[model samples]
Target: MRVGGTGHRLLHAETARMVERALHERLARLPADVLVGVSSLADGADQLFAEAILALGGSLEVVLPASRYREALPAECLGAYDRLLASATVVERLAYEDSTSEAHMEAGRMVVDRSDVLVAVWDGHPARGVGGTGDVVAYARKRGVPVEVVWPRGAAR
Candidate 1:
């Protein structure tokens, strides 16, 4: 199955675990032998979901918004991004040289276009910026993609 997701870049530890558990439960419903996870590998929810996919023996497909994605990520998240990138079965980088909001939106479109289902770890808040989690979820819905929102009760950013 082709699965993609979007969520916050920063998450509380409890929230992170909750998202992971939810991802685990969702992934459990699929056949273990041929699961694929598509994501940007962002610091919080995205990374957690990727890790869970890997843990469940699924293939990871990373979609980078721009060539300078590494530079855009916080220094602390660089290592995690690199690790996940190294393990990805596929890594597609957009043509943009810098990380811009437009680039991010295009990248999100790419993910949504390729996904059969989208898992959003949103908190029901308005999007803070272009290509934010809520915006991507909206995009997915607008495109008629099946979306599974996974914000556990009491989860916070």
Candidate 2:
């Protein structure tokens, strides 16, 4: 799985630190040339992992799952997302026709197919209408990709 959700809804500062530490330890065990693909959504687990990957000299491929930055995220998140995109080696826009449309599901499938590993920042459950991290995990699982899920402490719900 080349792309994964950042698990914004179920994370906090301490969890972010823990996740950063865990990912750093894990990435140290991976081959140095591994290319990590991430979504630039800087809410929860995703942002922390992206930062860790970059710090570890790993290349990042950011897949923005929205047509325009402004459409799906708040203005505050756009700046950081753009910074992540700028730092990434490759950036692919998933480009959706509608915010609530399922068309992006195919795009997700393609990203998953291209990725060798899938990491999700899950909160333990799915969000009702947003098609949250669960959607990405499901796609990766369907492809038999390796998955690493990061959950905040006490986040089981």
Candidate 3:
């Protein structure tokens, strides 16, 4: 089973923990032996889901939005990003020269395309920009991929 992840980068401290627990609980229900997680390895929700996948002994696949994707992420996210990237079972980097909104949306599309299901840690709000979590969730729904939303009750961004 291949699963893809999309969610916010900025999260409240308590909300982050809520999201982490929610993601782990949801992911734990999957069949571990054949599980493969696809993600951009961004901070917050992406990293949380990746960590859960690893904890459950599932394989991870990373998709890079652009050649300079790593440099575009927040400095604080670099440590987990580096570790997740290093732990990925497969990594696919796009041909974009820069890590623009377009690159991110394309990366989201790639994740949706490669996944059997899309897991979203969304709060049901519209996307702040062109390539935010909402857009990815919308795209996944449009493509008929099953989506399991992992937003915990009372969680806030």
State the C-alpha lDDT per candidate: 0.88, 0.62, 0.92
What tens-digit string does per-residue lDDT give for candidate 1 at 23-137?
8998888876888889988889899888888989889999999998889888988888899999999999999999999898888888889899998888989789999988899
How does model 2 fare in lDDT? 0.62
lDDT of 2 at 115: 69
Q: Give a tens-digit lDDT track for model 3, residues 1-157.
A: 9999999888888999999888888889998999999999888888998998999889999999999988888899899999999999899999998999999999999999999999999999999999999999999999999988888999987
Model 3, residue 117: C-alpha shift (Å): 0.7
Model 3 lDDT at residue 47? 90
What is the overall TM-score of model 3 with all chains considered together?
A: 0.97
Each candidate: RMSD: 1.0, 3.1, 0.8
Ten residues in sequence with the least summed lDDT for candidate 2? 1-10
Model with the higher TM-score, candidate 2 or 3: 3
Count of residue pairs whose backbone atoms collide, per candidate: 0, 3, 0
* Deviation (Å) of 145 in candidate 3: 0.3
Order of quality (TM-score): 3, 1, 2
